[model samples]
Target chain A: MDEFSFIDSIKPDSYRQSSLIKGIDDDAAVFRQNTQDIVTAVDTMVDGIHFSRETMEPYSIGYRALAANLSDLAAMGAEPAFFMVSIVIPSDWAEQELQEVYRGMASLGDGYRMDMIGGDTVSGKEFAISITVFGYVERNKARYRTAALPGDILFVTGTLGDSRAGLECINKKIDNEYLIQRHCQPSPRITFAEQLSSFNRVALNDVSDGIASEGSEIAEASCVDLHIAYDSIPYHSSIAELFPNQYQEWILSGGEDFELLGTISEREWPEVQQKAEELNLSVTKIGYVSEARESKGLVYLTMDGRTERLEKSGYTHLQEGRD
Target chain B: MDEFSFIDSIKPDSYRQSSLIKGIDDDAAVFRQNTQDIVTAVDTMVDGIHFSRETMEPYSIGYRALAANLSDLAAMGAEPAFFMVSIVIPSDWAEQELQEVYRGMASLGDGYRMDMIGGDTVSGKEFAISITVFGYVERNKARYRTAALPGDILFVTGTLGDSRAGLECINKKIDNEYLIQRHCQPSPRITFAEQLSSFNRVALNDVSDGIASEGSEIAEASCVDLHIAYDSIPYHSSIAELFPNQYQEWILSGGEDFELLGTISEREWPEVQQKAEELNLSVTKIGYVSEARESKGLVYLTMDGRTERLEKSGYTHLQEGRD
Candidate 1:
């Protein structure tokens, strides 16, 4: 088949009418919207490293590739819009597999109104997916990492570490499908995060690298220290027995939870709490941001009122030699 | 590292700000321009299929990968503004090789103000690079493949078959450095291709899959057939005499020529000729779009006025067993 004919067979036009100015046979796909609070982020997933060959499903991988990118948009207090995907697949992959992969990509991609305007495909030894998403936020109300100030109340969306706990549950001879699903599927807080945009949000980050690591990133970026009341962190009632210790490890170090970690001013606490309710998300004011503290780390206040610095709990590249 | 600091390491501000919008930490890199004429294209080069470890310098491969994408923008008469790269390198590639690869990519990338907005990287068994470039033309004036009308003349830039000749020279006893350079460091006629956009006069595409093949693509896309004058097809003067029979084969089937092959109306031929001279490129009127007289295929006219159907010349995805 000819080049254009082969390209036509791919047919990436499901969500084209929403914002794409031009789809194919053009230099770049044009997307336009009036007024501007633009939010954009990029994420790529690869086989073997990010996903194991034994455990990875092609359809799920395709879905997760787009999911991770859109989630980044959601974390920024922005509504997702258009997205561009680039893929490299093994030449030996069957056409049926390629179609199924697209089916999975479109499943998630269409719901978010992400017009698959452009993409590239080529032969490679391993499969890789790279996605870039563009979103728009209200100009003055963009939740920013730099906005976090001292005395701001800290909060997280949803239950802490269920996704991580799910991983452990799967490993410990627990014949549970829920835990594996939790690790494979990531439904980030998009609607809930956007509602918090106008709450004078001081700092923001997606907990892709666990809440502890991302919280540290926010602190570093905003130049403020966080003192979280660890005991106050919400948890699922299922693992209520070891929930405290497990939650600390999972919520603090578990990557891929895709939960949002951000701070808001004390004055805006009531509004944030009300907004969280409307979104069906659990919003907890775990602690406060401090200008300086005895420990420049997470501070956990015991139920008895004693406070101590939290230990670093996150994946390091050097954990088992360089990754 | 800080988020911005991490971004800074990839593209310094002095270079990042060179484009219309800085890509670092922006919601979306703003691409402000007055013209609605836009051109966009994407291409990828894989390490084993496109370049082998023994024959290619990784840095040169990196530069060439980027150059090939820019060539597509040129074919559409677009000036490249920015690009995104997706790469997967083998585990064995040293950190310095990675830096050198970026050095080459950035060198070519920076020259065109194509900010490396973002990229995806992972460890793989082989090295691969995919790039998508954005360029602009006036809306109606942007060149396209289906623009060729009946009786429109065909023109191509530069000499054909040079890349194929170079490829042959690399695998043989041809002791010519010139051929090796042309094959390994094929120049993507960016400025020249962008210039063609200004004329905005006809169907165009870069000669990636040989002039004969890409010419047919334009004809087929436009739904008009073509009749070519075989004698008018230009050849690299240096290799024209050494192997006359093989020279024709290279000119006809040699891929990766990286020259522009396009169509123009009889009325626009004068402007096309003048622009060719201005750019110091060899512009040859090799064919004309027509309604097929005998069989429904592109025809090639010999110097004696005898005509026959054009043959497809270049790389094909179908393996021997598949056909």
Candidate 2:
């Protein structure tokens, strides 16, 4: 099918929302937010680099692409309202496969109450999808990485490194379904973020590029230093069971966890913990933020009781050597 | 350079705008507008299909991608504020070339006073960029393709078929700077659109997919028949000078002109013409919307007074059959 026909065929039933003044079939999508500030994010996933037909299904590809953008919104404590998806498909792919991709996107959009507003479909030599999500946040209350203050207690929601472990399993053809699922369909911590933001969290970011990388970002942005306790970091049980020797490396540098990494005041730590327990979310307090020392960068206190400089190691596009 | 460093390097100097609450460092960009509704549009351009390195420079590729999205916002009469760009670059591209691509984007963004707030960069087999633009329009004043009325006078800003003709010149290695420039950097009609919206134009769309395709879209969406005068449509002088025989085909079916195609009330025509003249914008009256005739689709009235059915033929993704 051509671009127009394919778009027509998958024309989603107008899932109307009060904020959506206009949806598809227009030059641009129109939306309104009475008093809240708007939060917008865009993320792109490419075929071979981000995902591959060899390791991922079309549905997962679509789901994860949107999930990445949604994770960004989640970090901002925004309620996703609409998303636009632009896809470039290789000619060899069947229309059924493309439909499967949309099906996956629709399923996720339904869960988030996000309407598919507008996008473009084009042909390319490789398969790729770029999703832009629009959401709304309470005025002046949206979290930012630069908001972390000295003496703030840092916490992370849910376990990290599962996605990286899952990727390893896929590459090695391991038979762990949990790890595989984690790798394929990592969840974005939207509900947890929303609850945390209600308490005026200090700073927040999603664990997309590993804890070490994300922690460094928060510290750098806020002109502070993060002291993380290696032993205090949370990880999935499978990490210790299957990759015992490499678990620490994975926990520190494994990317794509999509969990919320944030900081809060020491006084509010108990209340934040209680709220997480109420929401049935696993919240781990792993570090603290402090004024930067004279000559040191991010500090990692290892299990061996030794302090070391934290290196910025994670999944970066050019560094992957995948030319 | 890795994605992080590259993004950091090009961090645009803080072009402070009152509406922008947060810029590139945040998880998602935040902005505010008191009463105006938000408008968003996304467009993607890919290697080979959209433009090849052999025929176009990286700057043009990036400029055209943003221009396409800006054109959509222009059609809605939105004042461009921010745009997020996500790019996938093949590994073979030098870092300088990638920077040139961003230079192109920054040039266009500067012209429109649009900020590049947030985006993602990744690796891919082919180079591609997707841009999502955010703008605002006065409440209930945004134009829509569905708003065209039966007696509304159809009009288009600037000349059509120039982009297509330019493509032909490039393909044939003809040294015509005007045609080539038209194809590479067709300006979006933002100022004209804003002026027309102030006058409450009936309906509007950009001429991205030729006059016939865009006209038929407005007609079908509004459930009215558009009677277009074939010879009355405006064209570039280069089309007549070079491809006289094919000029009609280019005018009717050639795509990517990026001119605003709109309609206005007959009573508003004289004032609209005056406004266009004051703005130094060339607008041509092409046709008028009419009550739909039974079992007949969009109609084309030729110069010889012969009526013909208008076929939906412009640029379509898969129809081009480029693998």
Candidate 3:
């Protein structure tokens, strides 16, 4: 079969039963979400760079590609509407493996109610997956990172360093089931993150690279200093016990934990709690903020009964600063 | 450097200008195009599959990866906006070569005013690049393959099969300039293709995978027959001499031509001609559609003035279809 026919064959049919002039053909696939804000984001995942080349499964590749992108949509407090994916892999890759990746992605898409609109498949010198997610938020209702005020309380969803520590533990052949699961699939706190309502002047972001890195970014972007309480910071007990010397650093800097770090007003703290309980999400208040100038607009915190200057933690793609 | 650190080291400072509410550190990045009509597509390119690993430059790889995806956006009649690129390659690839690749992409992006939003970089078993493009067209100007109806005239933009023929000539070391140039950098017809208005119904699609295969798809999806007069087809003189025995077949089925095939009404024919001449675009009438029948569909008029059946003519990634 020709490549065109192959695309035509594998391309998923649109289940959308609305005014869709084109599903997948032409210069683009058109989607009309009447009177709705068009939310969009793009994510690309590389092979060994993002995942373990030694033992990672192809299905995990598909899942992570879509999950990582979808998590972006969630970070914006937007509902994922639709997405398109592009895949490039070696010519000799097993056809079944490709399908497995698609199946994993489609499963996540199903969970998020985001339709897989269309994508392209090609043979490349390496494996690369790119996903573009389209989502929607009410007019001006979407969240941002610059909204954190001086007194606002900072909180992160679920646990931190689990995924990062998981990778390390798994590498060492440690018999820790919880850590392994975290490394395998870190839950995206989409539901909890999106429930953050407007009017709270809430600043929102997800922790992928690491908590301290993302915290400082939000702080720097907002021109505020993140005042963290190390004791209040959440983590997996297994990680703490296994790597005592590195626990604090890993918890602060270890990346790839797809959790949410949001700031809400002190007045709305109770509401945040109520909403979390209502949504069945764990809302942990781990820190607060002070003057940007007081700390050079960086992350500082109280740890072990001392006012310790918290070093920037997390993966820094750049040489100078954290992500 | 660790694989993760390598990805980190390659981070560009312009990422801060992504205008994404929360980026890089989060599960996803978010942006709103503020346009109501959303159009999207994705394309992937593999190494040693789409290009010669030995002869092809890294910059060419980046340029073509983007050009191919942008061509898809153009075919949809959507204004090119933003794109996401994902690349997975062997870790041994020189850092400078990767820089050249990005430089080429950034140059194209600068010319097109398209943003390099986000993507993944991983070390893979093979080299692969996946790009997903998000664009928007005016609601009143949305075009689709299903929009084509009876009485519509099929049209093709530019000449066809030059890319394939050019590649063949290069592989054979044909002592020709045109063939090698065409193979190296086949220009995508982005500007002139939009002359075909959107108010007009079109079974329009790009000749990316090949005219025959894409044409067949337009016919198949629209549930109509594509009747092509082989003599009406346009071609480069070099291609005509390169594949003498199967020149027509190659043009019809050859992939990567990046020309466009679409249908327009007889009433719009005058305007199309005026615009084509204005834009210096070659607008060739290949065939017209006939009534849907039980068995008579996808017809081709031979050069000897004989009618014959046409098959899907394009490249497939399967090993058997490879050169």
Candidate 4:
């Protein structure tokens, strides 16, 4: 099919919002302005770099691609509203394969009531999917990396290192369905993040690049020091049992976890923990924000009574062995 | 440098709008809401498919990419606001070369007061740039393809087929500065489109896919027939002189002209014509809309007193002979 035909085929059967004035088949999509602030982020995934055909089906590739952007919106405590996807299709991909990719995105987007508005489709040598997601947050309430204050309690949602373990299982050809699922279908913390919006101030970052890098970003942006107890980091039990020696690296440097890492005032920690329990979501306090000393914006990890700088060791796709 | 550092390097020196709350170094960019409606569109350009590095320098590639998106906003009759760019960089692209791409985009965006907000940069096998641009229009004033009436006057801004002729010149290694510049930097009709928004209602589409294809879209969407007098279609004199025989195809089927193809009411045409003259813009009346007969919605072209169907023969990248 041609580009226009492909766009027509992938348009949602019905748009969810009345605010969406125009959708596909237009030069641009229009949305009626509301009182809420707008939050947006874009992410692109390419074949053999972000995912391979052997490691990921087209459906998972599409699902994970949208998931990455959703995770970013979640970090800002925004409600998912709309998205635009630009895909570069290689000659090898079939019509059914591309349909499955859109199906994957729709499946994830349906729960959040996000609508696919408009985007571009073009032919290329290799497959690539670039998605731009738009969400809404209350005025001046969107979370930011620069909001972390000294003496705040730093916390993370869910367990870490599971996605890396899942990738390892795939590469090693191990039979671990849970880990594989974690790697393929990451749930964005939209529900939990929406709850956190009630607080007056909070600093948030998504753990797409692992907590080490994310913590450093919050520290650097907020100009505060982050001190974490490495022992307090949570991991799925299977990760520790399957790869004990490498689990630490996976927890510290492995990326694509899609979990929220944030800091809230110490006084509000109890209420936030109670809300997490009510939502049945795991909220772990692994660290705290402190005043920066000579190293103004640094992250420190305390392990076995020894504290050292927590360098940025997050996973850099295609950079591991090539560099 | 890593992806993060590269993103840091390209952050705009300053954002133009106070409504832009958070820009780079954040999970997502946040924008304070205003009363105007928001319009957005995305376009992706892949290496060797859309434009080869041999023909398009890094700067032109970046500038043209943003131009393509800005043209979409102009078609919607919206004022440019903010944009996000997601790029996939191959290993061969140096940091300086990639920075030039951003500089090219910024140079054009500065004219319209557009700002670079947030986007993704990842490693890939082929270089690609995907940009999502957002603009604002007065409430209920954004143009649409379905707004054309049967008695409207079909029109186009500036000249057509120059960009395609420029591409031909590049491929043939011909020396024509004007044609080459046309291919490298075809300006969007943003200023004219903003003026058009003052009118009550008008149907609009950008001539990215040639006038035939763009006209057909308006005809099809508005459920009217477009009858064009071939003699009246505008083209740069250089195109007619250089490619005497192929000039018709360049005007009819060649793409990437970035001009505006629209229809305004017959009663409003004279006033609109006066406004175009005030701005020194060439607004040509090539045809008029008529009630669809048996064909429901179709485009017809009259040449030498003979009328025939104007089929969709617009250019499709990478589809010329590979099929």
TM-score per candidate: 0.84, 0.95, 0.86, 0.96
List candidate 4 stretches off by more than 4 Å. A313-323, B314-323
- How does the DockQ of candidate 4 come out? 0.84
Better of 1 and 2 by TM-score: 2
| lDDT by residue for model 4 (B137-163), tens | 999999999999999999998888898
Model 1: per-residue Cα lDDT over B1-323, one tens digit each = 23333335556455443324335443234333444543455566777777766676767787878877777777766677677666676777766666677677788877877677655565677677777666665666666677888888888888888877876776675877777777777777777666666564677788777866786677666777877777888887876865665777677668788888888889888888887789887789987888755444453545445555565543232112123
Candidate 4 global TM-score: 0.96
Please rank every candidate by lDDT, starting with the best. 4, 2, 3, 1
Predictions in order: chain A TM-score: 0.84, 0.94, 0.89, 0.95
Report the lDDT tens digits of candidate 3 across residue range A157-211.
7788887777777678887888877666556667765677445477877777777
Model 1: residues >4 Å from true position, as ranges?
A1-9, A13-15, A26-28, A32-40, A136-144, A160-174, A196-202, A234-247, A292-323, B1-9, B16-22, B26-41, B171-175, B239-247, B291-306, B311-323
**Number of the candidate with higher lDDT, 3 or 4:** 4
Give the winner by DockQ: 1 or 4: 4
lDDT of 1 by residue, A152-197 (tens): 8888877767676766664564555655566666676778877776
Docking class of 2: high
Compared with the true structure, what per-residue lDDT tens digits does model 2 show for residues B1-323? Answer: 67777888778878656799899988899998878989998998888988888889888888888888889999998999998988988889888888888898889889878889988888888988999999989999888988888888989988988999999999999889998999998899888888876675569999898877888788788878888887788988888899987877788778899998888889998887888899898998999888878554364544555566676664233123212
TM-score of chain B of 2: 0.94
At residue A232, candidate 4 shows an lDDT of: 96
Q: Each candidate's iRMS in angstroms? A: 3.6, 0.7, 3.1, 0.8
Put the candidates in DockQ order, highest first. Answer: 4, 2, 3, 1
True-contact fraction for model 3?
A: 0.73
